[model samples]
Target: MKPAAFEYHAPATAGEAVELLAEWGDEAKAIAGGQSLMPMMLLRLTVFDHLVDLRRLHELRGIRQREQAVWIGAGTTHSAVGRSDLIRQSAPLLARATPLIGHAQIRNRGTLGGSIAHADAAAEYPAVALTLDAEFELLSPRGTRTVAAADFFTGMWATALEPDELLTGITVPEWHGRRGFAIEEFARRSGDFAMAGATVAVGLDADSRIDRCAIGLFGLGPGPERAHHIEREVLGSHVREVSAEEVGRAATARLTSVPADLHGSANYRKRLGAVLVARAWQRAVEEATDD
Candidate 1:
């Protein structure tokens, strides 16, 4: 398979990248890591006239930790984030979710920003980003603006990014050492796209009652959806004594008519969704206790 004819431009700086995107508009697409885009290009699923290579941009290649949050460069690879000492120690739920993305080779080349921009409904980054309430930095010729993760994904393979916008980086609140988190996905193999997935992030108050929680799940909707009903159900109780199965059932029931595919029937996926959510909640509770 071969990609359609396209101009390849590697820019060494974010400014150059945005300028080229401004020049080419819809004909140009940003290429960072190429873990997802390259395969699509080979299939001719996307016909780009220009690929603004972002690999050489040193500025978009590292993770930074601030007192309040963590900044991940758009060009940072999944492997990098998974193995990063800073991310593993501080935002480990992210590190936990990365390996679930794909195999070693794919992880080695996939960029966090690229995955979020791609917005695959079955992908890990989207759910993780949503779980963290992350914000994106999208750059265009006019300027840069931040978009909340919840407002980023519009639908399958779609985002709020404009035609000329390039996602430069993401900012996520630091874990704050008060939460217990878990990520679980059902895939055919070790690195296959998730058939169903769930991530639970919960914070406990001094009374051990759930204070706040975020549940991000995928493979049952147009995009990742927050399990608000489930979170609310658990917020006033201790996870150990709460009826997690009931919460899981309610959450799974809401996805009764999920879209189906060769990997799973809608019913089967719904079942997996319930199971994953339950297990993730259990793990989160244990971790919260330990914390």
Candidate 2:
């Protein structure tokens, strides 16, 4: 199927894109990479009178450390993110999670901001962003503002972005050293959307004990969700003594309150979520404790 006829506007700057959005409002859609928007457009699930292409916005196209956080241009490709040494050193959780998004081809074209804006409940980036407490930058005619990842994703395929705003960048705190991070998902194939998944990040104190931890769950809720109860349970525990079964049981109790779905029963998804969480926690602990 072909997308509906629309006027195309390629903007070389975010300000130019914002101007287009301000003029067209709900009738226009800002497209970066087209990985998410184009498919929906072709199926007519959504329509636009104008398409604002953002590939030429060079201002929004790099990854660098600013203050205590790493700012990634919204236009940065998943492939570039997955392969970035800077990301690997500063925010390894994000680097680890990027390859889990889809196949190589999908990663090649998928933009970080595009995925975040799309807000796929089972997508890797949203969960990672949430786990990392990432911040999103939104530009509009009004001005630019930042939104925390926790508040950015409001629902499945929904975000806090106003119709006239464009996502310009993402900021993640630098994870320095002595940190463990992992991403795990259950799916039928390599590129399939996950049936269940979890992204985990842990910071160990000098004593080699869990000091801080963040767990973001996907495919088990309306949107990416932080497993706060589980994080609380694991804090202060020694990495060597961490128990997957205990963590899994706790996660099951917390996540199974919802109804079932066609992909799996609510209980099944909860179980999957628990197992993934446990696996991620264990792996992250190992990575963090590595000499």
Candidate 3:
């Protein structure tokens, strides 16, 4: 199947792209790597009268290191992100999650912003972004603004982005001190989307007590979810004193909207999520303690 007929507009500047999107409104869609959009379009799941191509916009395609956080342009490919030294050193969770996105061919053509904007509950990038507390930069005719990861994702395949807004970049803050990051997911096959997954980031004090932690869960709810209640439970507790199984149970117990589908029931997903979270928690704590 082929996509429905659409006018393709390649804009050299982000401002031009924003204007095009603003002008077309609901009739248009901004396309970056087109990995996810093209598939849906081909399947006739979605239709757009116009496609605002952003490939030519140089402003949305680089990685930069800031004083405290690393800024990744929205158009940066998953392949580039995986290979980036800055991303590996400054934001290791994002780097670790990159390879699990899909196969090499898919990652080669998929962009970071596209993944987050698509907001798939089963995708690795969105969960990682939430775990790291990343910030998204948005541009529109009205001007620019930033949205925190917590508020950006509204539901499955939906976001807080307005019709005319373009996601220009992402800022992932660096975690200083004794810290560890890990991502674990249960996919049926190497390139398959995860059935359930968890991304864990832990920070420890000198005495090996958990100072801060973030547990990001995906493939278990309407959108990527944070295990806030679990984090609060483990904070200030000695790493050895916290049981991974107990933490996992607490995290999954707090979930209110686990999705059921052909793959599994909601209860099944919650169970899988619990195991993954426990595994990730153990791994992250081990690393943090080693540091």
Candidate 4:
């Protein structure tokens, strides 16, 4: 099957793209990279009367360091992100997670913003964004605004972005001190989507006490989720005294909406999620302690 006939508009600037979106309303879809959207369109899973191509918007395609955070343009491809030394240094979790997003071909054309906006619960980028407390920049005719990662993802394939808005960039705050980040996922094969996964970031005080921790889970719920209860449970505890297995259990215990599908049952995913969390926690803690 082929996508429905649609008028294609390649806009040179983001303002023009959003203007087209505003004019077409729900009938227009802004495309970047087209890794995800093209497939959906090809399958006829989604249809748009107008396709707003953002490939020519050069402003949305760079990686830069701000005063305290790393700002990545929305159009930056996964391949570019994976190869960025700046990203590896300032936002290691995002860098490490890049290779896990499908194969090289997909990463070559898949944009970071496209993945985040698509909001697949099983994708690595969304979970990493949530774990790092990244902020998203949105542009519309009304003006630009920022939304925190936690508040941006609303539901399955849904986000806080309005119809007329365009995601221009993402800001990931850099963590200082004895900090460690790790991402673990259980995929059946190297390029397969994860059945369950977790991204962990830990910050330890000089005395090796857990000062702060963020655990983000994916492929276990309707959208990427933060393990707030588990985070609170481990704070202030000495790293040696914290049990990775117990933390994993606590992380999955509070999840009320783990998804069940052909791959696994809800209970099975929760179990896998627990194991991934434990693995990720242990790796993050080891790195933090080694520092």
Per-residue accuracy of model 2 over 1-291 as CA lDDT, tens digit each? 999999999987799899999999999999989988998999999999999999898888899989999999999999999889989988888898887888888899889999999998888899999999999999999999999998999987899999999999999987766898998999978888898898888889888888898988898887898978888988998877878667766765666444366768887888888899889888988888998
Candidate with maximal lDDT:
4
RMSD (Cα, Å) for all candidates, in order, is 1.4, 1.6, 0.8, 0.7
Steric collisions counted per model: 0, 0, 0, 0
Report the poorest 10 consecutive residues by lDDT, candidate 1: 238-247
Off by over 4 Å in 4: none
> How would the candidate models be sorted by lDDT, starting from the highest?
4, 3, 2, 1
- Model 4 alpha-carbon miss at residue 221, Å: 0.7
True-structure RMSD for candidate 4 = 0.7
What is candidate 1's lDDT per residue for 40-65, written digit by digit as tens?
Answer: 99998889999999989989889998
lDDT over C-alpha atoms for residue 243 of model 3: 96
Report the C-alpha lDDT of model 4 over 1-291, residue by residue, as the tens digit: 899999999998999999999999999999999998999999999999999998899999999999989999999999999999999999999999998999999999999999999999899999999999999999999999999999999999999999999999999999999999999999989999899999999999999999999999999998999999889988999999999999899999999999888879999999999999999999999999994
List lDDT for all candidates, in order.
0.87, 0.88, 0.94, 0.95
The positional error of residue 60 in candidate 2, measured at the CA in angstroms, is 1.2
